[model samples]
Target chain A: MTHSDPLTIAGKTFTSRLMLGTGKYHDFTVMRAALEASGTQIVTVAIRRVELKAPGHDGLLDALNLERYQLLPNTAGCRTAEEAVRVAKLARAATGVNWLKLEVIPDPKYLLPDPIGTLKAAEILVGEGFTVLPYIQPDAVLARALERVGCATVMPLASPIGSGRGLRTSELIRTVLDGAAVPVVVDAGLGVPSDAAQALELGADAALVNTAIAEARDPAAMAHAFALGVQAGRLSYLAGRMAERESASPSSPVAGVVRLPDPEIPA
Target chain B: MQVNGQPHPFTPGLTLHALLRELAIAPERVAIAVGDDFYPGGQAPDCELAEEDVVEIVRAIGGG
Candidate 1:
């Protein structure tokens, strides 16, 4: 099935609805192959301890050709709004890309985003002409507030980052999709292909998978599976689903149900 | 003081963390790769700097 309306974020059109992260792959070669197999147009990269000016490190950056996939640099390790803003600016300058994935996690254990810090940083980044895509909790009100701040997209976590718990916030996720004016990209904690499919089926504009695909027995194959799952989910959502009923009832009467024993008759 | 394989002036008596703070660098943003080992941000305070030591303080930048 062909995708009629490709997903677009921050004026960039992506044929693939799945946004894959570049970390946790066994090797760069495997990562390259997985990215190709996944057909991911955008890949996320964390900004943490890299000597960009060093000559030898150029090979790592060179391996990722900007033409094939757009580089989305994230402020992954930031703890506060000030730190996030600073990192976002530095990332924009270093990568020459305006797109940023704002991730401000105060808690190292869970890596859960600090909503207040994320919003504060996002507001500043958006005003600074950066295309901010905040990794936020599945809070409908927070999603709306982020949209109001001119965020390019709102990436709500399906669960804690790297926990692989799957969609623990399905209800809140649905609420976000129903209310969000901007794209809702389900990011993080997607353990497998089915998790990604579930997110897509729930009307998420895109799903970001990193550890699940990278840590698989075969990263490339897993990437392909995720790609298919995302596509299936998107198609399912587009096709729409029948409303579910609380109690089970036959849509058509059974042929043998015509005669019933009298109520007073003993079995 | 030695940083990234270059000798630089340092206060006669200052902790590695103090030197970093004097440079207006956030400890969290910098990772110290000393000798053949990598020390996390928190370890900087106790790890005193020695002359001609290969103190590689790598900062986080944008890249995959």
Candidate 2:
């Protein structure tokens, strides 16, 4: 927590450890406020093609202040590698940030990122000079595979996307963390501030949160709480925790017990 | 004509700019694509569209 340097990923440096998601808020005003309160440097935005609003009417981009936060465009709706790459290119063309969150989820029920498709898209994105951070299941093999293919970081999901279930895949996520050389960003399914704190305490490089804060009654306050949680967790990680054992240690010396007279004997 | 996965009336001489105007989209707000080809925000005016082309109007939305 005392660290003052930027977080480096794939040769790029960012000042914020908490990456905010600009989704599920009631409106842009609250979203922007929450973003400011969180003090996030990176904001993840999805690529969407919807029915156009009236001309001169601004969308989320207008609400976003790029000077305050860097926009990280994600291939959120893409179900294949081709789709993800296409979205990635479109995002770069639009926002001009080379950093992307490569998400290719063909399965909608669980919203799990497709392993093969993610790996494929990561290769293409890396070759295209994009800093790729792939959202994936907490599969150790897939995490390593993504790292080998030149992804800046591997973001393993805590639970299903938007489930707010919180770290359903703890063991596997730990498995991935154990062997990860690059940063392991715990992404998705984080429901509370403690979830993020726990992730950092487990030695994750960071956590990307959205639904928890955005869906809260007071998003701005929740955002601040999460920022505090991240700080606490990171500090705890740096501070280190005590080891565990099967039995308890002596609280007082056995030899230090004082002798006393029996009241019934009336000594 | 399909716009945003919905069928619309097809009209000849429909340039990308006119389509945006018809849909009331501020050209600067979104990035355009016809099938797999992406055009810069400014290119929408010159880029002509063909019938049956799946035009994608991509805007930034909230994500995590």
Candidate 3:
């Protein structure tokens, strides 16, 4: 409940374990309110070609108070390592923040991250002194590889992007957690707060959410709910869990049962 | 020169600031990349643009 135990990534500490994506909001007003409600210290934004006279592009720079939230620029639309690297450079130049969410999603249909591209980009970006957080499929080996390559974090998706599916690769995510030397932030395809909570409960350092909160009936309210869920999950994880058993265990002492006289017999 | 994948009229010895002025794009709202050379918002003023270069002007948008 307190901010004593902070989530540390790349030597930076964050009180809130929930990260938010600044996309799919109805407007900047709602986005601002949701972001404030979510209590997210880091917000993800995409860098794309600025369309002249575009409505949405002009406002985000002004909406987010940089003092309150740290902007994490993402290479969302890039398909290759080179493209992702270029976007990372452009994002760093534009945002003046070296923190990057390196995403190289080549397949547009499912919007899945390319493992090869992501690894290559992570290596290059980390080499350039950028704090790279590479998003990839829930592959344990790849997660370790990225960690070895100096990535700040390995963000493994729970499911396909924007699918609203919760923890389809939970087993794989567990494998990632098993050997992880760095923080693992579960990113993408979390449908509800429970999904985010589940990620934390499974030993994830954090969870990044977008569609679930942005598209909610009340984005701000849902954001608050997610924050609570994350906290609850973290607390529960710290509190630990009971062991499983095949048979039922009695809450009361079985040996303390009072013996009753038999009604039958010679009485 | 190509801007955002569209062919634009090449101005000889054009600086990035002058090109932004010509296109009516606010320099603070976008980051420019001339081929592999990158220029953050404020630093693009002195960067020169070449005729055959592909220029990508990008802005921060909502994304997860």
Candidate 4:
């Protein structure tokens, strides 16, 4: 029941199993505080073009204490393998870090990943010495394929990104957990603390949460709750669980009890 | 030259570093790429900006 071991992805050990997505916060200061409360060691940032400088406004990097967390640069808008590769390289160049969350979302309506492009990009990035963690659909065969392509981790979505739909693909997620050799991270659509806990209970190595925490009234408190939920769920998973039964069974032993309940039983 | 979808007047021998300075952007906070070719680390400062180049400047933005 004790969750003592740290989570290691791409040979890097992390004390927290929860990875936060830095997005959709009303204030950056609040986001920073929420991140600290979540106790997450890694956070993902979407790559985009922007004029980040303004009077009295420091950059997101400066605002966020980079010392406390690892920056997971994501190729969010990339729709092709080539584009993802280019973005990954640019992210590495800009951040000076090889860790990347490779996302190839060809479909804009739902923000679902393009598996073909993802697999292609993962192969190239892994060959190029980058620690690639791909965001994919909840497909076990695809997770295995990605791991075969040498990805550092396989992140399968529970539902559409930011839908807050929780785990719609529970069986599929279990499929990946059962077979995939690499660590399976349940990413996206985790609505609340219980959703995150359920994913951990389903045997996921970690969960990547965003909109739910960021959109909450009190992001810091919500993040803290999620951290505790993750730990509790992971402990429950580690401690083992009873097997499922087709029918109800009595908890107390009936053999040693007196057999004087005939009136109530017949009635 | 086009920077982040805006057409900026191309200067003679403008480097990526110069463009970042022109935008008043901190270079440490962004990633720059001219088409498919990404300028990695210190090399971004050396890549010369041409008029036809569409410089895509990327930063760490909020997202899930």
Top model number, TM-score: 3
Candidate 4 colliding pairs, count: 0
Looking at candidate 4 chain A, the ten consecutive residues that score lowest on lDDT are: A50-59
lDDT of 4 by residue, B1-64 (tens): 7877788899889987787777776656667788777764345656787889988877667876
Candidate 2 chain A weakest lDDT stretch, 10 residues: A49-58
Which portions of model 3 show Cα errors greater than 4 Å? A53-57, A255-261, A265-267
lDDT of 3 by residue, A1-267 (tens): 538879999998899999999999999999999999999999999998877545334558788899888789999989999999999999988888999999998899999999988998899999999999999998989998999999989999998888999888889999999979999999999999999889999989899999999999999999999999889889878889788899999999998698788688667
Stretches of candidate 2 exceeding 4 Å from the true structure: A52-58, A250-267, B7-12, B43-45
TM-score: the better of candidates 1 and 3: 3
Instruction: Write one digit per residue (lDDT tens) for candidate 2, span A1-267.
Output: 335645777776766678889889998999989999998888999877755543454478788988877788999989999989999988886676888999999998999889999999999999999999999998999988888889989999999988889878888888999979898889999998899999888888888999999999999999999988877777888889989889998878988588787688965
Model 4 DockQ (Cα-based): 0.58
Q: Write the per-residue lDDT of candidate 3 for residues B1-64, one digit (tens) a residue.
A: 8988899888788987787777677778578888888888677857777889898888888998
Q: Is the docking of candidate 2 incorrect, acceptable, medium or high quality?
A: medium
**Native interface contact recovery, all models:** 0.18, 0.74, 0.77, 0.71
**Clashing residue pairs, backbone N/CA/C < 3 A, model 3:** none
lDDT of 1 by residue, A147-262 (tens): 99999999999998988899999999999999679999999999999999999999999999898888889999999999999999999999998899999988797776767778
TM-score of 3: 0.95
- Compared with the true structure, the alpha-carbon lDDT of candidate 1 equals 0.80
> In model 4, what are the clashing residue pairs, if there are any?
none
Clashes of each: 1, 1, 0, 0
Model 4, docking class = medium
